[model samples]
Target: MGTSASKLNRAIMADIHRLSLNQATTERWSVKEAVEGCLRHGIPSIGLWRHKIHEAGLRESVRLVRDAGLHVSSLCRGGMFPAPTREERQQRIEDTLRAIDECAELHADSLVLVVGASSAVGLVDARKMVEEGLAAIVSHARESGVRLGLEPLHPMYAGERCVLNTIDQALDMASPYAPMEVGLILDTFHIWWDPYVLQQITRAKGRIYGFHVSDWLVPVPDLLLGRGMMGDGVIDNRTLRGAVDRSGYAGPIEVEIFNQAIWDMPGNDVLSTVVERFTSLV
Candidate 1:
C-alpha cells in the first residue's frame, strides 16, 4: 500500500474548500464595497442580490468583483414565478431572463431561484406556474451559460415567497427537464424542519449547485427578518454539512441572513461577525 503521507495528500487534494458570504448578511454595504470587504477577509466567493446590482451600475459592479478576484457563488435570486395575470407571469419570465444575463456578466456560478408564490390562485396552480416559468427560462439560461439554483423557501414562506416549499418539490420541478447547466440551492434554515432532509439531499446528489446557511429562531418573531446566526439557533450545521459532503457536493456555503438587528449594525461589523461565527461557531 502507499505511505500514509501519500494518502493524506490525496485526501487533502479532494477536500472541498466550501465557504462563501452572501451579501445580504451585510445588507448595508454597497455591492462593490461588499465584494471588496469579502476579498479583504479572504472569502473566495459571494452571492449577490439584483437590487444591489442595480444600485451599483452593472458594468462597474462586475469590474469591481473582477478586480478583487472574488467568484460570485450565485446571483442572489431570479424565480418569482407566480403572478395573478398572464401578462404579469410573462413579465416575470422576461425579468428572469434578464437576471440570467446579469449572472452571465458577473460570471456567477448560478442564478438562485426563489420561485414566487400564488397571487390570486390556489397553491397548486402557483406551483404549476413556477414549473412552467422555470422551463421557459432554462433555455435562456443554457444559452447564456448560466446555471439555475432553485431555492425552496420554508413552508411559512409558501404563501408569499415560494410555492415550492420542499427540496423534493424543487428537485421534482428541475429533474425532468434537467437543463444542461441547471441545479438547486439547498438552504439549511428552510429545510431543517423537514424530517426527510437527508433523504432529499441524497436525492439531489450532483444537482445541488449551491448551499446557503442560516439558523432558525425558536418562537420566530418575524417571518422575513428574524434569521439567527448559524450557531445562535436550532439547526445543526455539522450534520447538514456532512450530508452535503457525502452527497458529493463541493460548493461554497453562502450565508444568507435577513435579520433586522444584524442589518442595523455597521456593514464591516456585520461582515466581521459573520466571518467569526462561520469559523468559530458554525
Candidate 2:
C-alpha cells in the first residue's frame, strides 16, 4: 500500500462515518419519509433537494430533520448563470440569493451550484455570465454563513446543465473569492473520467466543501439519468476516496444516483440498498 499514515487514518474515518444519502436517489420519497428512511437505514445525514423541502414547507422540514437527528449534508443546487438577456441574468441572481437563504434555513453544510449553460451563447459568453453571477452572490453567501459549492458537472452537461465542466474550470471560477466563501464539490460520477482528477483533488485540499460519490455507467443511456450505484459501475472509489481524504476534506460523501430504474424501487428498498452498496464499496 502506498498510503501514508495520514491517508490511512482518513480512510478509516471515511469508512466508519461520513456517508449521506442524497434524496435524488429515491425520487419519490417525501421529506418526512426521506428522513425516516435515513433513520431506518442508520444513515446519519442527507443531501436535500429543493422540491422535497417545498413539499413539506421549509420550516417544517427543518424541524422534522432536526428532530430526526440528521445533518443536511448539502442543498441540491443554487446556480443557473447563463441567460440570453441581462434581466434574466439578474433574475437568476435574485433566485440564487433566495436559494442561499434557503440553504441557511435548512442549516445545510453547503449550497451546491450547478451553474447553468446557455445554448444560445458561445462557451466564452456563458462562462462570463457565471463569473458575473458569482460576483453578485458570493458576499451574500459569506454573510449567511453558507458555503457556495461550485459543482463542475460532467462535460456532457455543459451544453445545457452547467458550463463549468472540470475541476480546473471550477477552481478558476472560485479563485477570486476566499476559500471559505467559495469551494468545489468533488462528485465522483462527474469527475472520475478526468485523468488529472486525483491530482486536482489533492491540490484543492482544504477548499473542498462537499464530496459526492456515485458510479458512471458504461454505455451510459441517458446523459443525465444514467448514474450507476456505487459498486455497479467502472470507478474504483476506494482510490478516489483516498484522494479526497488526503485533500483534507472530512465532509460526508453524498450518494446521488439518477437512474430511473433505481428510482422506481420502493423508497425503503432503495435506502437499504444504498446502505449496503456504500458499505461494501465506497
How does each model score on lDDT?
A: 0.84, 0.89
Instruction: Give candidate 1's TM-score.
Output: 0.92
Backbone clash pairs for candidate 2 read none
Candidate 2: tens digits of C-alpha lDDT, residues 164-205: 898988998899889998999989988899999988897888
Q: Model 1: per-residue lDDT, tens digit, 74-115?
A: 897787889889999999999999999999999999999899
Task: List where candidate 2 sits over 4 angstroms from the true fold.
Answer: 1-16
Tell me each candidate's RMSD, in Å, in order: 4.6, 4.6
Candidate number of the best TM-score: 2
Q: What is the lDDT of candidate 2?
A: 0.89
